[model samples]
Target chain A: MLNLIANENMKIYRRMRTWILVILIVAIVLLTGILMKTHEAPPSSNWRTALQAQTTQLQQELTQVQGKHVFMPARATAGMEIQIKKNQYEISHNIAPAQYTAWSFTSTIEQRAIGVLLTVFVAIVAGDIVAGEFSSGTIKLLLTRPQTRARILLSKYVATLIFAVFMMAVTIVASLVIGGVLYGFANASQTYVYMDASGHVQQMGMIPYIFTNYAFNSVSMLMTVTIAFMISTIFRSSAIAIAISILSLFIGNTLVAVLSSYSWDKYILFANTDLSQYVFNGPLISGMTMTFSIIVLVVYFIVMNGLSWFLFKKRDVALT
Target chain B: MADQIAVQIRNLTKRVGNKTIVDGLSFDIPKGEVFGFLGPNGAGKTTTIRMMVGLISISEGQVLVQGIDVEKNFSQAMQHVGCIVENPELYKFLSGYQNLKHMARMSPGTMDARIDEVVKLVGLQNRIHDKVKTYSLGMRQRLGLAQALLHQPSVLILDEPTNGLDPAGIRELRDNLRRLAREEGMAVIVSSHLLSEMELMCDRIAVIAQGKLVSVQTLSDLMSGGERHVITSFEVGDKALALSILNRLFKDHVVDDDNHPHLISLKIDKERIPDAIQALVEGGVRVYGVSAVTKTLEETFLEMTGDGIIA
Candidate 1:
């Protein structure tokens, strides 16, 4: 069995797509960072200049509505003037400031970019783990070995996991290095997360936040890998399996969002995608719990692996 | 026979969907002998070999290798058997040496010295370090053989081992397999559609057709199944008169050709060749020469299969 695992690792390493996926992920992350660095006026950034510009626009709208500077009479208005000025100040303050520098800008980009790249990397690695063997006609040689079919499939699964870990490590390390160089590492230790419902934002230490983010990304990556593996085993075609897996990753969240308006959203695989949303946001959407989402994902993982093993063991590999 | 039997299949059958691929095929290969499996295309040779190697499941009946049931203890039974079915698919990206080294690791007892010996045995020492994709077809076949022999199994099953080799390569493979069987006490079962090759290499042969075993016998037994007749050709003058005299003397023994008057062939037993020669000489026809034409293995195979041996 150890020999089989080693052979599986060798096969995975030799495939061109595995390296291509890794390089693609690293390239995308670095390119996005460079683009963000060069493009100083990116619309996503928050700067004081843009904020003041927006504040002026809101004041102009108010002037247009009343046809003049609407100031209350100081003596006869009975404190109405003070209340009106307070409301105006509140509206002006609410307009977002655009004091966007490297620290704030790179953080948001890194988070979203890493999440998307990690998801894609997981799907690519897991989707082709078994299907490529079928396409290359190597599955017959593998099955003819003196080991059981289940053992062979399990070894492949383990190898896929190893590849997933390697890819994630590469992506994370690349992001941190490029992010530090471009956006000076001063605010790197600050946790910038938005709070939901209460209209507030909380700041945590950077190391703990980054660790939490890594853990969350790992869960999502596992979901992608396991799901793609199951589909690959069942379909036995790399393109089809990969297409279906990625399409689900993109569309599944939308489905959960639309379905959550009704009562049946909890059962969908997409509902589990935003595992960090509740913790980062406020209360769960429609009173969902973290434990419930974890359970749902765990069940999905078990079912996918079980089905993969069953079908792979029973498949007749006559084509290979 | 009990001590000699290396692999035994009794009433073995396999079916894919509704079509029966192997139907009630039975054969016993003895120890230290080269057994040839001969059949036309799609004659269930691959299916039978797959079943023997525990690659495919047997629908009915069982396969016994060295007195162990293959289905019951496939891993243990397979430990004593090595096989290459169809095109010996190996990892193209891996070097020849790496491929064999990996296979050697499967059997824990095998050593690096054994791998070296097999690599040299296959005459691939010079190019064993090169990737398999860069090797020629003959070289790939030799590398596959080296891998199969890495564990030194007692029984080796090769399906169409010499399918695409040149004449010299084929001869080399035949000599090597013969030497292995003779020297190492290994039972080798090789399947091929080439009758002449099998005739030269196999000690015993089992011919299959349409998923059925047609005959199983020693090479000599199969060769001597029909009447042994010697065809003697003679170059003579006045072939009609010479033929009439020869036909009258040896009734039902002469075959005359109208195309050439100076040539005629007479089919007779070896013992009667002298008598026919004396009578032909007395007929007053000038005889130039006479020589006996022996039957080739091709003719025997054609007679057995009821089809032309070479298409």
Candidate 2:
């Protein structure tokens, strides 16, 4: 079994596709960093001046209202006017400086870039792990050796996981290096996350945020890898497996959105895509929790992998 | 025959849909014998070999290799058997030495010395360092043989071992296989559509047709008992008169060609050739040349299979 694993690892490491995937991840992360660094918000001078003038006018009106209420309107129904003035004051004071600065922008960009990169890379690597042997007519030679079919398939699965982890590490390292160089490293350790519903944000210290982000990203990536590998084994054709996996990644979200509008959305695989959405939300989304997503994903993983193993074990290795 | 049987198949039948590829086929190959499996295209030779190597499942029968049931303990049974079904496939990116090294690690008790021995056995010493992709077809075939023999397997099953080799390469392969069987006591089962090659190399041959075993006999037994013929030539004036006289005297004993005169052939018993010659001479027909024609393996194969060469 160890020998079989070593053989599978050699095949993956020697393939040109593996290197191509690694290089593509680094290139994409670097490109994301460059785009973020050169991005500006059209100077924002006009919007700032307009906002200042509005604030001054609102403050002047509040002062006049206060003077009137203090002098003669004490007995006259002044409570309603005073409430209006208080609302105006609250609005003006809340308009402080914008929070979407370079630091916050880089963090959001890195988070999204890493997610997309890991998803795509893991899907591709895992999808071709077993299917490629069938495509290339090597499976016949491999099975004829003194090794069980289950061992052979398991070795391929383990090799794919190793490849996924390697690619994720590459993406993480590249993102951090490029991000720190372009944007100052002063707040490098801080966790800056954007809330999806209200656009509210939070800042946390570096260690806790980085560890949590890594854990979440790793789990998400593993889910995609396992799913793709199962599809590859069930189909035994690299082209079909890869096409279905990538299409699922893009279309699964839409299906979830459509299903969520109806009553049956909870059963779809896409509904669990946001496994970590609860962590960033000030409060978790109603009826959706970390435990729920984890259970749903674990079920999906088990079913896909189980079917793959069954089909692969029973497949007739007919190579013409 | 040796006390140990290298391979045993009993009532083995493989059916794919409506077509039965191997039906009720049973055979036993004794230890240290070079057995030849001969058949035309689509004659279930490859299917039978695959069943022996555990590449395909046996539908209704059992295959035992070296006393172990193939279906029950395939890996353990396969450990004693080495096979090359169809073209030998190797990793194209790796060098010849690297390819052998990888396969050597799978077999128990194999070391670098054994690798070097097989490499030299296949006569690939000069180019074993080159990538397999750069080798010629014949070279690849040789390298495949090296890999098969790396484990020093007791039973070696090879399908079309000399498919794409030149005449010299074929001869070398024949000699090497004979040596393995004779000197090392390795049981070998070789499959090929070339009957003449099998006749030269195998101690025994099994002929198959339409997924059925037609016959299994020694090479001499199949070729020795057939009818013999003798060719007799005559030169004479008035060819028509001579032919008439000869036919009248040796009726039902001669075959005359009108287009080619002075040439008559006789298919008589070997012992009766002298008597027929004396009788023909006394009847006043001039005998020019007389010789016996050797029977070839091709005629015997055609007579047995009722079909011509596939190509």
Candidate 3:
């Protein structure tokens, strides 16, 4: 099993494109850091003052939310209150706000936006891993080996996931290191302040929150990779697999938001992709909890991969 | 499952949709011999090879590689076999060495030294480190042969292995295959539409047409063994006089073919050659030259297939 996966890894890394993608990722992160530094926001001489200002801002937003009563005002009201209380707690504890710190680079909602870009990179690898072989006519060489189809495909799957995990880690670590170099490293050891799903303020050490936030964001990334890989195996066309994966990534959230009025929206595969939404932004619909989303994601994950494996093993590899 | 047999096909069949592409073909390839699948275009040679390697699903029957049924346990059966179906499909982005290394890793317990040895055996050591895309067609075919030999399989199956090779490359591949059969005791099955190449490369040939096996026999048997008194045509001066003298002496064996009256032809054995020539000369028909029309395998193949559309 190890040899199988190692063989795949060798094939993957030997491509110049994989390294180009990696380098592009690090370059993007560094460019973002440099731009943020050059156009530096107002320096927070004292985090206490920043926290007080943020708390006041959330209060005003909460009043406006109540006045308008639009766009799920209840959830919006709960979300504003949670953010305000968390800001107040940070202000009381004397933990200064620093968005550019290594920990904050991972934990901050704005910084977590980079995860989508990382998802595209990982999905590209997943999309190409299987379909690229077919396109290059190497699938004949691959399948005729001594291993069974199941073992061969399983190894490809494991290798793709490892690549996904590796890319995700690169995103996190690169951002963290860039953020630390541009800002300061001391904030990495600070406390992690956040709002839980129940509109309550919570606090944890920065290290734990840093890991959890990255891990939490990866649920959606893995979902996209699984879909991309499934398409790769079935269609044997890298272009179709990569295009559909990227299209779904950007359009999926909007479609869910547009179709939120429907009762069946909760069951849609895209609706359950962002598990972090349950804890970070609250559920898209009432009564949908993290555990419910977890169960849904697991089913879709298993079913998609089940179809991939079944088709990969049984389908005839014609002389394409 | 005989110890000497490396591969066995029993009633193997394939059907795509409503068309039966290959129907109930069976053959055995012995160890230490090069077996040839001789057929015309679209004769199902590739389809049968695909079924042996489990690339295409078999519609009926089975292929046994080293006594293991391919359909029942594909990996175990494939463990004893290595094959190249159609063109040698390789990862163009990878170096030739990396490609062979990848193939070597697929089979468990493959020695590291095996890759080096095969590289040398295929005469690819000089260019093995270059990317496959940079290599010429002949080099790629050599690399393909190298990878197929990496695991030291009991059976090697190559479909049209000489497709893109030059004359010299074809000769080199023929020499290597013969060496593999003789030195390593490996069973080899090579399919080709080139009858001359088959005659030079294979010890036995299986002729097929329209998805059905026509005949499978030793090369010599199929070529010249079964028939006695081969038709030998003589181009001589005054073929009419030569024909009369030879006809009177050997009767029925000698005749002046109406197609070319200047030449006399006869169906005579090796012992009767001197008598036929002496009769022609003593009759004042000066025999300028004596030659036998050695019927080529191409003629036999065309006769068996009933068509000349061989690829």
The segments of candidate 2 whose C-alpha lies over 4 angstroms from its true place after superposition are A40-110, A194-203, A206-214, A261-264, A281-286, B225-250, B253-263, B280-295, B308-311
Better of 1 and 3 by TM-score: 3
Instruction: Give one digit per residue, the lDDT tens place, for model 2 in A1-320.
Output: 77767777777777677888888777876787677556733445465566556656655665766777434443222333333333443344432233232344344544776666667777776787788777766566677777788888888888777777777677666766776676545533334333432233344554466556667777766767777777787778777777787788788777876666676677677777566577665223357666777888889888877888887777666536
TM-scores for all candidates? 0.83, 0.82, 0.87
lDDT of model number 2: 0.73
Q: In model 1, where do residues sit more than 4 Å from their true spots?
A: A15-17, A41-111, A196-203, A254-266, A277-289, B226-235, B250-253, B257-263, B289-294, B308-311
What is the number of backbone collisions in each predicted candidate, taken in the order shown? 8, 1, 0
Chain B of candidate 1 achieves a TM-score of 0.91
Using DockQ as the measure, which candidate wins?
Answer: 3
Q: Can you write out model 3's per-residue Cα lDDT over B21-89, one digit (the tens) per residue?
A: 889999899999999999988888888888999999999999988889999988788778878878887
Candidate 3: list runs displaced more than 4 Å: A41-99, A106-113, A189-195, A200-207, B225-287, B308-311
True contacts kept of 3: 0.84
Q: Give per-residue lDDT, candidate 3, residue A256.
A: 88
Sort order, lDDT high to low: 3, 1, 2
Error of 3 at B249 (Å): 11
Q: Is candidate 2 or candidate 3 better by TM-score?
A: 3
Ranking of predictions according to TM-score: 3, 1, 2
lDDT of 3 by residue, A38-112 (tens): 886665787677678888988877777667754454555666776786677566655554345666655552244
